[model samples]
Target: MSDNSSKLHQRAVYLRNLLIAHVTGRSVNEADYHKLRHYFMGHKDTSRIIPSVLEKHPDLSDLWQMMKYNYASHEDRKAFIDSEFSPFLAKLSPDSSQPSQALLSQNQFIDEPTLLKHWLKANEMLEMNPPVASEQMKVLLEKLCHQILRELKVVPDPRQHDLTPLVSLTERSLLLSPGKQHYLVVKALVAGCSEAMSAIDNLTAEGISVITDQAAIPKIDKPTSLVLINLYGSLASMLLSGWRVRQMLVEGNSQR
Candidate 1:
């Protein structure tokens, strides 16, 4: 397995063991509530693949709330782990070994500078430096849009800076019209990707605090960045796949 795949597998194993300990054993109190907070802090990337954990216990600070004074949430949290997480973890066992990105074929990412290089750089800094990684994702998406336009023999609009405009331009170039059977679904997916790009834009840049109405927004975390990265890769794959179909159709028509 590739190094990224190995890391993903290790993370899956660790999380499974952690959850099992909580759900199993003699009693609920036997579980270490403090470890829950530690897991979130240390493994921020967990939510990238297994987001349900964060969905259940989003407030990391609240893990500390389960200290000696309070034990009300312990049983409830354990139950969630048993019902939702256990099954997911079971699939991740070394025998099965299915990570989120496992569904994506390796051929989707070519060994080019604009594509794989930036993705690797961004992933390296994903946990340690989320802001930097987020910036890389933006650049990757922008460059990909530019490349797609170039491949179509069209001049990309220099004014189209952000992802949404570039994506709209890409769609226009690809003839993503409303008359198609799956047009609505494709449009919705494209729109969702655009929204993800916008969300990434909102993430803290260069460690700079994002302030709104005198309130500072939380800095971009690993899980959020990873999700955006996954989304970007998926969108890139979709665009390229459509472009390839168009290219073949054009070649066939020209040959006729």
Candidate 2:
């Protein structure tokens, strides 16, 4: 099978085991997963590359198809074998001899262990002290959003999920006690603005209509109050809010 296919297969196995655990109220025995491995290797028609390993296995074909298609590159395939699949295989055969010295050193950093460790340490610090103010939350939220946008641009495949940990982290930092309520508010605000912007774009394409609302009345009578109530002034203020959101998304891109 192709590299992408292999990765997909491993992901399928992980998901299957997860579902089984959820349904049965028990985790799969990592050591006794011969059935799954056998199932993956049994069928034909797929597993083109590693067919010799399980050519005659009747069940391997279906298992192989689930994972073989998503591999977009050789690196992805190698990553799957080294990071996800090999660990499970290790669990299944614990008595196997040690890996070669080079492989052993490389395995130690699989799953980008350096990044994971840094994330864990930062998490521990946050847990201990806690974010106490909105300002702190704002800085963190911007950083998180920046990271999300960066990843979105780099990872072209639809199968790769973004790091949602940033969302929760920013949410937590922003509102300590009333986090849940604020989270809903933030979601609604973003959704509403996005919808409104789309509507504005559509409307502008047709033609701009200047409505003669009371707020649009001339300021000659009461210049100061009229300035505050003028339709154009109000529209400009509203436009600024939308501009800010655009700036936020844009600023994040430049920073990276």
Candidate 3:
């Protein structure tokens, strides 16, 4: 088998074994199984053409090797996935009080930067050398860019003390070597923030009629305002990771 084919086979086997363990309730934890399952569900429609990739980018052997050994044992892998996803899932209400039909029916629109990252990557790969690599690169880049935007939101709104830790976190994540786990954590945060922010912005822009009560409005001072702007630039840096990942994926894909 070609190297790409073999790697794909190994991943497929790993997934299958995980599923079996999950069903047996003996090997994999329930939470980990669900988390890994959700990641796959999120991109179920995408095709993973491993053989074609190997044919295009033969040089990926070393990089793939680096990634292969990094994953922990299957059990540890599951725990990591669960932890990465737990925050996002926790936001959903368990109580049965039904949300308004209007709120439920609104077509969820991902935020501007998130959507832009996806569309831009897709556009760039339209005439690329390898179709599969081009698409994967696009998705990875989109995720990275959206993640940066999410970090922006994490920085204190300037109503608090220094966000040095938050800033450090953003920089640390960005500087890490590319790997599947890193991508997952960053993407989940990005997707969550993108969804939340879009909802907030939409509500705020819904004309003055909908927001008749201005009595309790809070104001931001100059330092806070400047901090917010700087936060935006910091987000821009993270967003650029998508482009970098895109270039790498595309280059690798083309070689196949």
Residue 251 of model 2 has an lDDT of 69
- What is the alpha-carbon RMSD of candidate 1 to the true structure? 18.8
The digit string of per-residue lDDT tens for model 2 on 123-169 reads: 33232112111112222222333333343343223333222333333
TM-scores for all candidates: the values are: 0.42, 0.22, 0.22
Q: Across residues 122-156, which tens digit of lDDT does each residue of candidate 3 receive?
A: 33323221222222232233234334535444332
Once superposed on the true structure, which residue ranges of model 1 sit more than 4 Å away at CA? Answer: 1-121, 176-218
**What are the lDDT figures for the candidates, one per model?**
0.49, 0.31, 0.34
> Backbone clashes in each candidate structure, one number apiece?
0, 15, 7
- Residue 28 C-alpha lDDT in model 3: 40
What is the C-alpha lDDT profile of model 1 across 69-174, one tens digit per residue? 4433433344444455444443433334423222112123332444555566567657544543554465456556666676777775543334677776776676
What number of backbone clashes does candidate 1 have, counting pairs of residues 3 or more apart or in separate chains?
0
**For candidate 3, which ten residues in a row score worst on lDDT?**
208-217
TM-score of 2: 0.22
lDDT of 2 at 45: 25
